[model samples]
Structures are given as C-alpha cells and as structure tokens.
Target: MKKMKALIVAAAALSLSALLLAGCGGAPANDKKAEDKAPAKEEKTTLVVGLDNAYPPYGFIGDDGNLTGFDIDLATEVAERNGWDLELEAIDWDAKDALLNQGTINCIWNGFTMEGREGKYAFSKPYMHNEQVVVVKADSGIDSLEGLAGKNVMTQVDSAALDVLEDEEGQKALADTFAGGAAQTIGDYNNAFMQLESGTVDAVACDLSIADYQMAAKPDMFVKLEPLSTENYAVGFAKDGDQAMVDAVNKTLKEMYDDGTIAELCEKWGEYGITIDNWVLVD
Candidate 1:
C-alpha cells in the first residue's frame, strides 16, 4: 500500500508540472495574438493636395500623362513613405482659397507665397526660398530695374507682385521711379513670360527658379534680367488649429530638405536654389 501511494503522488506531481508548463507556454501565444491585432488599430489616412497642373517645375503634367514636378514628386514620395495615398487635384489658382476653405481640398501644396498673405492663411514651414527675377531679351538695353520707366511690364493676375505694384505708396513709388510705366496682369505667369517672348511686353517678372527652369528647357530664349523681391514658398494648410496636417507636412518637408531631395530637384531642373536667410520659414 505504501509503494502504490508513492507512485500515485509521483504521477500527480508530474501532472502538476505539465499544467504549469502549459500555462506558461499559452501566455506567449496570447501575447502574440495581441500583437497581431495591434497593427489593425494603427491604420492612417491618405493626404490630398491641390495644385495648378500648368505650373512648371513646381507642379505640372507631363506629356506621358503623368503628374510630375518638383512639388508633386516630392509630396508623392513623402506620402508613399508614410503609407498615405496622395490625390493631386488640378485646380484653378483663383479657386485655390475656396477649395481649401470648403474642404474640397486639404491644402494647397504648391509654390505659395507667405509675404503678402501674412496672417491671411495658415502656412507650413517654408520649404524653398525664391526671388522674383526680371526677364528680358539678351539684347535689351534694360540692365536694371531703374530702367523700366515707361515700359510695359507683365505679371500674373491677382499675384502678389501686382499687389506690390498697386499698394498706394508702392504704386506711387513705382510711377515716380519708372516714369509711370504700367505693370499689366495676365491670366497666368506663363502668359506674362510669353508676352515678353512675343515682344508685346518689355519685361516679365517671375520667380527666378521658374525663369531658370523655363530658360533651361528652351535654351537661348530667355534672359533673366535681375531679381525683384525674395520670398519664401510654403504649403498652405487650414488656418485653424489643423496642426495634425501641418505636423505631417512639415515633418516630410524637413526630411526632404535634410536628405538633399529639394536640392536634387533644383539641380535636376538646372535652377540655382535660393538661400534660406533671404526668406523666413514660418512654422
């Protein structure tokens, strides 16, 4: 009877050891199951950006039916890295503000200016600094801004440059300095350049990077006279506390700047990148 009791106790101890091992082993499986479902809760939303499809070097469509440009390409790469879908909406420049306000688009991811529109819209930290360069023919006698008097200068309709010319004091200054020459506003910046090309306008005032890109693409056709005013280019997000989108975009923009993506794009387009000190980066 004693021997039988000892064997029974030994079997019970073995069974208890098996039960303890089973519980410990099952704990790992439960932890792994919890991990498997964690990713499901981490899904994120894609971003949609609005831009003008005809703006070259910044954002535009290619002959291959692809939407490609400095901004478009950079934004797309950022979105892809973050597992976000990017919807590039081609909208009229005049409708840009309306679209953003109505949520028709999330943000204007283009070469938006921050100077004249100060405190007007919410802006991301400036991505690239630029200056407006004056364009003229190589043979034109116009070597500096001082010589623009009585000349027909061109700019884009509703552009900040036009504002610079129209502000009462600014307009008076322009008139007195340039012999009261008029600065006409065309439908697009390209039109202003074209007017210069066709000899219809004396000069074209445009972003230096853009003028460089245009001249490089069609060499021997343009001559950037001189830089007008330096400005910072940034993306426009919602004006309110839409900090989420701002954080995401500014994060990607900084990444691009650090990784030489922005510089590469400038070099690829053969335009000299502007220095940051000349313009401010609004966060």
Candidate 2:
C-alpha cells in the first residue's frame, strides 16, 4: 500500500509539471492576440479658418451661398497636405480680432493686408505683394491718386486706404490736402465700387488685387486709375507671441515657391507678378 501511494504522488507531480509548461508556451500567443485586437486610433488634426464672406476673390459667398475664394483654396490646400480637416468660417470683419483672441477660430485666412495691421497680431510671412489703386468710371477723367483731390473718394472703414490717408508722413498728406474732400468710409470694397457706380463718389481707393478682381468681374464698366500704395498680405493669429504656426506656414510657402506651386496658383488666380518680398519670423 505504501508503494502504491508513492506512485500516485509522483503521477500527480508529473501532471502539474506538464500543465505549467503548456501555460508558459502559450503566454506569447495571448499577448499577440491582445495586440492584434487593440482598438484603432485616429490622428487629431483640424484647422479652422476665418474670413469675411463679402470680400470676393480673396473670400466671399458664392452663388451657392457657401464661402469660396482664393484664400479659401489656399487654406484648404494647406489643411489637406497636413492631414487636417478644414473648417471655413464666415465671420464679420469687425469680429476678426475678437474671434481670434477668444480661440473661436485658429486663423484669419482672408486677404488680410500687412500695411496697418502689423504688430497687432501674429502674422505669417508675407505671401503676396499688392498695390492700392483708384477705381473710377471709364469716363470719369480720373487718372491718378491725386486726381481724387477735391473729388469724392471712397474706401472701406478700417481699410489700409483709410490708414494711409491718416498717416502723418505717408499718403495722408495727399488726403490731408483734400481734408474734408477725402475718401468717404464704406462697408467694403463692394460698397466703395457701388458708390462709384451710382455716381455718388467720383473715385475709390482700395487694394489693387480687389480692383483686378473687379475688372475681371465687370471689365466694361470699371477701370483702374493707378497704383497708389501696395503691401504684403499675411495670415493673422492671436497675439500670443507664439510663432510656430506662422513659421510652419512660411516654411510651407517657401516649399511652394521652390516648387513653382505659388507661381501656378498666382497664374490660376490671375495674380501673377504679385509675389512676397520676404518671409521671416518677427517674434
């Protein structure tokens, strides 16, 4: 009976050893299965671009009432390359600063000029250079910025034109000569041009790019006087002093310039010969 008990104990020990070996051999398989069934993860990327819905060629509402324009296309291309979802926001021109400051949007991607707005926001490297021109009827006999002197001139409120007219040493001298006869303030270039159309204003002082777009839109009715002032356009962000976004955009733009992408876009948009002078981080 003692011999039989010892044999049973040895059999039990052998069975336990076999069970331990099997468990150790299958451990890697369990781990591999868990790894294979792990949940898939999506990368986070979203760019919200803000713009005025009334500024055409740069940004405006299409016949479909959706925002579409050159700036919109440019921002969309950037987002696509960076694997980000693009959210084009139609915002009021007056609300741009507040919107950016409050983080309601990531950037003001409109045709935001760098003339008077410099130092007020974090700006991307200049992407395009443009001039301000006077728009008058074909028969208005206006041929120069000075021709608007003593005549009704129209520009948008808060526009570079207004600032230029107010500059102590700049074009303000020209407007100062006119003083009470200086350009009237309007809502936008559209309104300025409309005032010219209705003969309520003799001339309009605004950016050359918008004038070019207007010529493209209504070639027969309007003509440009001459380029008065020009400036580079930039992307504006909150004044957080962080330039990572501006730097990235500048780098991308440089790549675009090197690859002829900028040239192509300009030609496609009919803004050829308009190029950025320099791209550098200010802060």
Candidate 1 off by > 4 Å = 1-44, 168-172, 175-181, 271-283
Which predicted model would earn the best lDDT? Answer: 2
The lDDT for every candidate, in the order shown, is 0.72, 0.76
List model 2 lDDT by residue over 7-90, tens digit each: 999999999998998888787788889999998898766778888777777888788978877778778777776677889888
lDDT of 2: 0.76
lDDT of 1: 0.72
Please write out the lDDT profile of model 1 over residues 70-177, one tens digit for every residue: 778768887886778889999888888888888888888777767778576788887777776777776778887777888878877666566666667444466345
Candidate 1: worst 10 consecutive residues by lDDT? 272-281
Per-residue lDDT value at 33 in model 1: 90
**What TM value does model 2 have?**
0.77
Best by TM-score: 2
